[model samples]
Each structure stands twice: as C-alpha cells, then as structure tokens.
Target chain A: METSCHDALLFTAEHPLRLRSGATMAEVSVRYETYGTLNAERTNAVFICHALTGDAHAAGRRPGDKRPGWWDTLIGPGKPIDTDVWFVVCPNLLGGCQGTTGPSSTNPATGEPYGLDFPLLAMSDFVTVHRRLGEHLGIERWAALVGGSLGGMQVLEWILTHPSEVDNAIVIAASSRLTAQNIAFSAVGRQAIMRDPEFRDGAFQAQGTSPDKGLSVARMMAHITYLSEDGFQSKFGREAQSGELGHNFGVDFAVESYLEHQGNSFLSRFDALSYLYLTRVMDYFDPFATPDATAALAADPAKVLVVSFDTDWRFSTEHSRRIVRHLEGARVPTSFREISSPWGHDSFLLTIDDYHRTISAFMERAAA
Target chain B: METSCHDALLFTAEHPLRLRSGATMAEVSVRYETYGTLNAERTNAVFICHALTGDAHAAGRRPGDKRPGWWDTLIGPGKPIDTDVWFVVCPNLLGGCQGTTGPSSTNPATGEPYGLDFPLLAMSDFVTVHRRLGEHLGIERWAALVGGSLGGMQVLEWILTHPSEVDNAIVIAASSRLTAQNIAFSAVGRQAIMRDPEFRDGAFQAQGTSPDKGLSVARMMAHITYLSEDGFQSKFGREAQSGELGHNFGVDFAVESYLEHQGNSFLSRFDALSYLYLTRVMDYFDPFATPDATAALAADPAKVLVVSFDTDWRFSTEHSRRIVRHLEGARVPTSFREISSPWGHDSFLLTIDDYHRTISAFMERAAA
Candidate 1:
C-alpha cells in the first residue's frame, strides 16, 4: 500500500511516560495522518486503528506522494471508507514510530528515543488517546471505528468504554482478549526485543539502528501466528523457493520471503517499543476480565459486526464466536461470519470486498 | 525420560543402498532400543521413527534410571503399542545424533567429522537407511511404522518407497512432503545454524562450541510451529515470566524458557552437523514430485492411518489430508481423522490413549 504525504502535525503528552521505573502518570502525544475532506458537520470523522505493525500511512499515491492513501482500495473516492464523503484520521499509536510519542519518539528530558523506558500502557490508554484526538477534532462521536486484529481490539474497547462515541464498530479477524498462548507469544517477542543488548533499555533511538535482528525475529514469530496451519500449508508447503537450498537461512520459501519482508519492513515503519506496547495492550485486553466477565460484556457489545477468516489462526473463528456470543447476549445488532481463506490472519487486509461490503451495509444501518 | 543402554546389539539392513558418493554396500548396520518382548509369531513389530532432533529413546524404563521412557506410557507392556505382545524397535536414523553415522561421524578419508563436506541426503535416503536397519534385524516387515511430524514424514515415504514393507503406516501430525513454507521454516533454522560465523560451514565440530545462538533461534522458530495459536494463547500470551520484563530478549515468557530449554538442551545432545543433514533430508523429500511424473514408481497406497490434531500447526491437519488424498487416488487403504487438541503439532507427541488406541486398532488389523 502507498503511504501518504510527509506533511502532518504531531503532538506528544505534556508528561512523558517513565517506563522501566514502573511508575505511572507519564503522558505522550501522537502523530496523525489525515486525508479526505472534513465536512462542516464534523460528523463524518472515522478513526481507523492499524494492525500490529501498520502505521498512519494507510494509503496514498507514489508511496509518499500524499495523493492516494493507505487502505486506498477501501478508503478513497468511491472506495469503502470513501474519502469523497467522509473524513478519515489515523494516528501512530503512543508506542508507534510514525509521528506518535512512542519508543522511537525523542524523550524531551534526555532528547533520546524512549526505548524501554516508555511507560507500559493499558489497551485502554490507546482508546484514551483516540478519545483525545476525537476531542481535538471537535467530533462528539465517531461515525465508525473500523479495525482488524489488534486494531479490532481498540474498536471493541472503544465501543465498550465510549459506547456512545462510535456509531458503528467493525472488528475483523480480531479477538476479544489475549489468550494465554497469545500472551506467551507476545512475551517471547518482548523478550527478544529486550534481550537485544542494543535495545539498551529503550534508549536505542540515538543508535539510529534498532535491534533489527531481534525485531525481525519478533515479527517473524508474529507472522507465524497470523496464519493457520492449513493456510500456511496450502500457501507454502515444504517447497523450497528455489527447488534447491544453498543451505542458508535467509529464506528459502515464498512464505519465508513474506515473513522476512514483514519482519524487515516493519523495522523501517514501526517501532520495536511500539510493537512491545501494542502486543501488551492486546495481551492485557480481555474484555471478559471484569465483573461477571463474559455475561456482562455480552450484554454490552455495541452495534458490532465481527468477521473472522477460517485460515486466521491468530484470532481463529473461535475468538469471533466469543465476541458474537457477547453481542448476541447484549441483543445488539450483530453480524458474524467466518470467511474461508488460505491467507490466514492477513485475509482481512487482502479481501477488501467481502469486509468492505459488510461494513458498508453496517454503516448504513448505524448512520440511520 | 531416562534412557537405557540396551545390549548394543548390531542389526542388518533390508535395502542396503549404494551411496551417491559411490560406495556400494550390501547391508546396513543398526544400533537400536527396543521395548516389550516380541510375540511368538514375531508379527507385532511396531517400528517408531524419530523426528529431526529425536533419539531412539521412545518408551520404557532406562537400564538403571527411574524416569520413564520418552514414549513410556504409550508403549509399555499394556500400553497402546502393547509392548506385551508387540515388538517395538526405534532405530536412530543415518544422519542422526544418537549412535548413527552422521555429520558427527568421522570421515574415513580425513579422519574427521563429515561436517559440511558430508554428502547431502534426502528424506528417501533416511528411509533407505531405516529399510537397511530393518533387514539387518532379521525383520521381514514391520506390523506398523508409527511416527509424528518429521517422524510421520518418514512413515509416509517408507510406505511410498516400499509399499508392502510395512503393513500399517500411522502418520501423525505430518505431511507427505515439506510444503514450500515448511522448507522455508526449516531453511530459517538451517540459516540460523550455518549463518553463525562459528558454524564454520558445519565444520564447527572442531570449533569448541557450535552455533548455539543460531541453533537456539532455529529451535525456537521450530517450537512455535509445533504449537497451535490456541495452545500458545492458553499457555503464554504476553505475560512476563518475571511479572515484569527486564524486557530485552532473554526468555521473558515461560514459553521462551521452554523454547530455550529445547534449544539449549538440543545442542548438548544433538550434533549440529547432523541437524543440517537431517533437516535437508526433510526439505529434499518430494515423493510426489517424480512419482506423480513417472508411472513405474506410482505407488499403490499402502494401508495408511493419517492422524492430525486440530491445534498442531507444524504438520497441520491439512498436510495430513494432502497425503490421504494422494493415497486415496492411488487406491491405498487409508483412514484419516482430525483429533481435537490445543497442543498443535506437539499434540501428536503428547496425546496418549487416543492416538495409541488408533495405532493399536490399525496395527492389529495390519498384523491380522
């Protein structure tokens, strides 16, 4: 997907997070990229949350030309998120690399990237920032909050915490909470990132070059989870990319290339600190962790549409079912479907139509 | 489980193959471990094949140790494989770590480990070695050839190459051939090994310490594939093993500890040279590549029992289906089932009674 133009105003929290220290009360602002025209009513603002390694540069032209947009197929003129009629805003999360005050952001006090020293934030903190951004835009409520996987987690929390803030919530191929194993996976990733001596307790910003190896490994690990065994086999079964191996580990399968690309490119566009933060947000994100848990949350699934891919092992259909059960319990209008795909968790990014149409219909009802 | 030192009996081979490097051999020799006594007719031999890093220590008590065998409960006197009536033999493969002529084996010409200079082998080569071992043991045929994942791959190739050699083939959590993606994963592991400067082109046998980091990373990578997303989420989602990460990459999650244990312990027992050799065997295995092309070699699918666990992603159940479909087309007697498990590919190794019973029924019929 092409990235947006280089121009965008950024802001950070008045008080920066004091991570590693374990004390709270740290604040950080976010960097955001916006496209499409904001209507006079300001009622058309739609905030989009990105996947694990995604950024505010959803789509545009020429990769940085500032014309098209990320999620271009679904966000421009006549597209699903139709820029022609709606205003779209995406922020680099608190721990993201884009323009937000994340691990990559320079710590005002020391003028260094906050690497590991960034305060550990709850998933709700992300929603809180979205709320602030919404307030800054002078929008009382969101027309829709659309996201997939981790992004979907935000959408879920948004609807739950700020129930009246978003009119429609579209969560795709995402789970309601972190499973123990998912938490374990994230723990390993964080370990990988933290283990890289160069990580230097989150002060790697001045180093310019982050823990590319550890980050790549973390990405590679995450990449593995995003796909189902069936999907992985169907797409990349034991065939060497070149029928023969020089016997080195650069990547000998098309899938390895895909994973490597994901791992490597992510380092360029996303922050490792952000990666740790977001995964943590996801891990600590059990909507059913509180009073009465599932039953209580089930009664509060706000006008939601949950979509899952059969091939997505990360948030398999089972996760979707849990959300559906909650929504069904809440008696909130809900649509749940498990699309068959061999693309794994990535199915959400590629299959624009099925989901686009689902959301389109969903928004129609929400707006009415 | 504790290992027992059997009498160290020497065995014979059935199809002693000539080495591609030009050594003509009449029969192959085998050093093995057995459990349970053979029945009067000697028809209940259940041959167990080990995975890439596995040893011939499948079941029963060690010579003097208290720890049960690796596959103890499943193969003891009255266990599933029924050591009471069936004879079980697990032979260390040709390019294996345990008591086999592998990379660790000294080269006859140079009087050093085969290392990188050793001839590369395919899955067929490993199977051929196993066949030789079978012949040497005075065993005409096995009642059942049982294995999981890589071991399962051997089982599949064994039946394809010598269709009638084994009456029953129980392939668990494995595919007919490594998918391109599978090869890619293994390639990553191999790269981790050989890419290490210390690897010294697998000649690291003389280099004091092998590529421990690379090998550990490789093992970690493989370990992820061994479990299902559900299994991972249930076990280690993002929770810090220490409640808070010193967060760099030193094993923050219990899963990381588990993986590190696997990786580190593997290096202690497994020779890195053989690791490269055997992994290649798995990668080069393409039974269907030429078999589907040539008519004479088109195998009559032997009686096969292919089992898959819902959670085992390494050799996803879909892989099992690919094998079953090929066998079905070839008119080979095959039975396929997807057992429910959250353990992923490891389920094939962990699930006891269910898998054992499946093998029991399948082997009983084959012997009959």
Candidate 2:
C-alpha cells in the first residue's frame, strides 16, 4: 500500500523533447510515483495516466499526508488495480502544474517561467513524454496502460501510436474526439482564465499576481460538469447552507458553497497557465480523425477496455461506444461496459462495485 | 401582426410597489408590446411572458427595425398563438434590462442606477409586477397566460397566486424548484460577473466601465446549456473555424468561435447587474415549498399545459412533470407533453412543428 515519489531528468539538450506543435523543450523532468514493485521481467509495470487536475500520486499516502491518493479506493493490495501483483506508475502530465515540466517550469533560455511562452501541447505530446518516462524507468514494454478521463486519452493514444509498447489498455470515460459541447465548455474555462485582469496574458507569475478569480471561476464551472445531476440533487438539492437563503450573492445553497470551496482550494494547487495549456490539449484532441490511426494497432493490437458511467454527461456512454466501435473496426480485441453510477465522469475515480469488478476482471485477463 | 411598444408608469410614490424582500420601489415602469386588437369582452387578451434575456417585443417588426419580435413565428396572425383571434401582450419581466425596472434602473432614493442596491426579488415579485401590468391594460381577465423558461415560472406563479385572473396557463421549460445542478450553473455565472475587476461591487455604471468580460463569459457558458449536445454537434461540431487548428487559443474550433461570438454579442445587449438579480430570482424560486401553494387553484383552476423538450438539460422534462404532479395533486386541470427537439431548452423559442401545433391546439381549446 506504500507509494514513493520519483523525479527523473528524462529529456535534456542532447535529447531534447519535441512537441506535437513543433516546439522543442531542451530539458524535461518528470515527477512520478510508484506503488508496489515491478516484477523481475519488468513486464508487471502498469502505466497510469492521471486525468485533468490529477498528479503523480495515484495511491497510498506519502509520509505525514492525511489523505491517500485521489484514486486510493480502487488501487492497493488486493484492490481492483491490485498493487500486490502489478506495479503502478503515475506521472504528472507533460503540461501539468504538479511537479512536472510544464508552463510553470523555468525555460532554459530565458530562465523564466514559460507561461504563455510554453509550447502548445496535444495528447500526442503527453504520450511522447509518457513513453520517455517508461524508457527512463527501464520499462521495455508496459504490461498495461490504465487511465480515466484525460488519462484515458493517453492510454488510447499509446495504443494508437505505439500498440507494441503495451499489452493492455484501459480507457475509461474518455473521448477519442471531443464533442462541440465539450470544446465549448473548455473554451469558456480558458476564456475565464485569459480574461482575468491579473492574468497579464498568462505572464502573471512575473507580475506577482495570479488570475485566481478567473481560475477559480473556471474550476467551479468544470466541477459542476464532473458530477451528475442526480448526484447533485441527492447531495445538495435545495438545501440551504445556513438553513435559509443568503438573499444576496454570497452563498445560499450548499452546492454554491461546495463549488466555492472547490474553486478556492484548487487555486493553491493548480497554476492558471497550466490550466490553459492542459485544457487546450484536450480541446484539440482528435486522434481518431487521423487517417489510418488504428493501422499501427492492427499489427500488434493491444487488448482494450473502454468504460463509461451511465450518468456521465461529460464524456457519456456514447463516447466510450465510439472508441469501442473504432477499436473493433480496426480488428483490435476490445471490451466495452457502461457502469451504472450517479457520479458522472467522476465515477471512474470512485469505488463502484460493477466498475471495479469490470476493471479487476479485465486486468486479470490481461495479466494472464 | 404589427407590434407596437408601450411603456407605462405602473407604480408611483403614492402607491409604492412592495418587493418580496420587504423593500419598496417608489417608482416602477413596465415596458410591453401588444399584438392584434383586444375584443369587446376584453377577456380575449392573452398575456405572453418572455424568458430570460428576452424583452417586451414578442412579435412583428417595429418602425425602422430590421428584425421582428422574438416570438414572431408563433404569434403572427395565423401562427400558434393566432394574433387575429387573440390579443397578445408581451411584457418585459420586473427585474429585466430591456426598458423594465430592474437592477440597472435608477433608484429614486439614491438618484443613481440601483445596481446591488436593487432589492432581492422572488418569482412573486415578478408576478406582482405582471399582475399590475395586466390590470393597467384594462383587461378584467386574461384569456390565457403563456410563457417559456423563466416566463413559464411566472405563469406558474400566476396560477398559484392569481388563478382567477387567467383562464388558461401554458408553462414551458420551467421548474418549480431549481435542481442543485441548475443553481450551480447560475452560481458560477454570477461568480464570473462578480469576479470581474470592472464589476466594482456592481456599481460599474457609476465607474463608467462594465464587466464585459465577465458577462461575456457567463453568456458563453449559458449559451452552451441553452443548446442540446446534438444541436451543437450538427451546428458547429469540432469543425475548425478556419479549416485548421489555430494551435494557440484564439478560436480554433467552430464551437469556440460560435461561443465567443455569442459571448461578445451578449455584452452589448445585456446588463451584468440584471443578469445577477434575475438568475438569483430563479435560484430562489421554490413555489411548491410554500404551504398549500396550489390551494388557491383548487377552487377555480386555470387549465394548465406544461410542455418540456426532451433534449432540454437546463429544465428537462422532469421539471414539467414535477409541475404537473403538483397541479394534479391539487385537483388542478393540467396537461403535459414531452416534445422531442434537438434544440434543448431553447426549443421552446424555436418553431418546432410539434411544439407549435401543441400550443396552437391548446390555444384553440382555451379560447373555446
């Protein structure tokens, strides 16, 4: 149940990291966490791709930490992920604010935070960094790649671009191509951040101010999408925060207070520029649009499992079905399931019986 | 089909209007538009309530105007509401921006725009002003009260508070109590406006600067909800604005471009203070929560038709169903219809064949 952090200098001047946008990073450092132990053959390693707003910490608590990882419920010894049998490695995404080389990182040339100067990223860039991290970890090939939401996008990208690198891919609540509505929501979030007076064109770091208001607004809005309407009704409903309406704009409903807390707490952990770049990465993600995207998977197809929550409007069951359809059309071994949960896109992070069982059964089959 | 605007001083210092918040408006004005002629009975008058962001104009083009009224398709001579047979009057709601007494209106006490000083309003306050407008029109009783979205809420309020005043009530795409998710969206929108530096504590008019960015962002987010997923997919989808990704953040996808256009265009027409007050009014709307809310309708019920579009996630069919259940429980005559449309909550505003036909048939029955 223990997890340890690992920071590796993955890319340097001699081995610069090239982004999908044609920009190169002279130095790239990856911060990751590992749970359990890799087997002797190094084939027992399962690459975990964290979703938006997620970090390298995938399971168990670090020293002195009060809470375990974000997905701690489903990842541990004898759990669905079964850390006892397989090693789990999660890295902060390439353009992430968390302890990774992202927009907040210092640019080697200017020695200032990249801010808006950072190269625009795509899902491919994230997969590229992930592959380098795998190589750095001496993982010749991953036994499996597992992820949900944005993480799920990485798993699909790996299967599409380098199927031979992984034996199994678990894509949960992810879309091969974002719907127009999805893009619109992400666009609004980006607009919120960019429009903040303190944003200073994403160079707020140099100005000693942050686009906290804008970032908070963006997070609050996105947080609403992460939960199901039924979930919200059950949890908050018309419940007044102080037993009566605030009458003014402070916080009348429990839902508003909850969102305010979510927004405020997010500012302390997330960077505004990183939010912009990472969301942009998801916005432009159109892997299936690429001609012959699955042609590579045809040769050494990875066993794929696409999972979606029934109530997940963010990336609905249709999104997973589309991914399954594409994989099946490519003659790849694929399984799809729509788990019943009231949690929406966030159900992937929770310990729902059916969802965990599906993953557990799939992992067992893949591992065998 | 001709529509002429009418502005009336509905309240004065001699007879001040009392608000739900116990505040008094010494002076209040109502802006409305009338289509067709009132019959000798006066009961032939049909009062139309406009939704959020709507104005007094409901049908026909005014002098020197390029566009007809908002509901021109449904309110013309031979259209759903049939102007030739029924005199239709559409009034701007109480706390509205378009020539109505609202948060943006001047407070006689302060001699400045009310802004945040505007009293917190409820659905009852809107209904109170609406009733005054009805009386001022010299109509003893309305043949029908028709509305959609927030307008629908007003119709419901009329049924609950003044059932004897209207023969029929058609409420479309409204909720008796906003779900937590609904409130969450409104709360984020308010946050977006309030967080803007230009807001200046809602006294932006005094400062000669508007929260244009914040208001635009709010509009962009709400515009997404006003549309169904299928509508966005068909209308904009992931199609690039310029046939290629911009790669940076300035309108890459067609949806983003469309949303930006919507947001930008909204700034010139809508007031931030009004947006705040009106959305708050909706958030606090819980008519059914009041004791024996439908008791007044028990004695002389207004024939009610509650309509909802299947694709409307904002106020889904469940909202309409809830209204019907409440009315039915109180022995009020009510009919319900779940119309299928790709337009989502905005479906009520669109001229869908089934929707129009349903309204037309109901109007005929109500007139009979």
lDDT by residue for model 1 over A187-290, one digit each (tens)?
A: 55665666555566667777766666667777777777776666777776655567764444346656777777776777766677787777876765777556
List model 2's recovered fraction of native interface contacts, to 2 decimals. Answer: 0.89
Calculate the i-RMS of every candidate, to one decimal place. Answer: 4.1, 0.7
Global Cα RMSD, each model: 4.8, 1.3
Residue pairs with backbone atoms closer than 3 Å in model 2 (clashes): none
TM-score of each: 0.83, 0.98
- For each candidate, report its DockQ versus the true two-chain complex: 0.32, 0.87
- List, residue by residue over A1-368, the lDDT tens digit for candidate 2: 78899899999999999987788999999999999899988989998999999999989998998899998987899998899889999999988988899988999999888888888888999999989888888997998999999999989998999998889999999998899999999999999999999999888997789999999999999999999999999999889899777788898889999999999999999999888888888888888888998999988999999999999999999999999998999999998899999989889999899999999999998778
Ten-residue stretch with the least lDDT total in model 1 chain B: B2-11
Q: Model 2 over residues B239-271: C-alpha lDDT tens digits? A: 889967777788878898899999998888899
Find the number of clashing residue pairs for candidate 1: 55
Top candidate when judged by DockQ against the true structure: 2
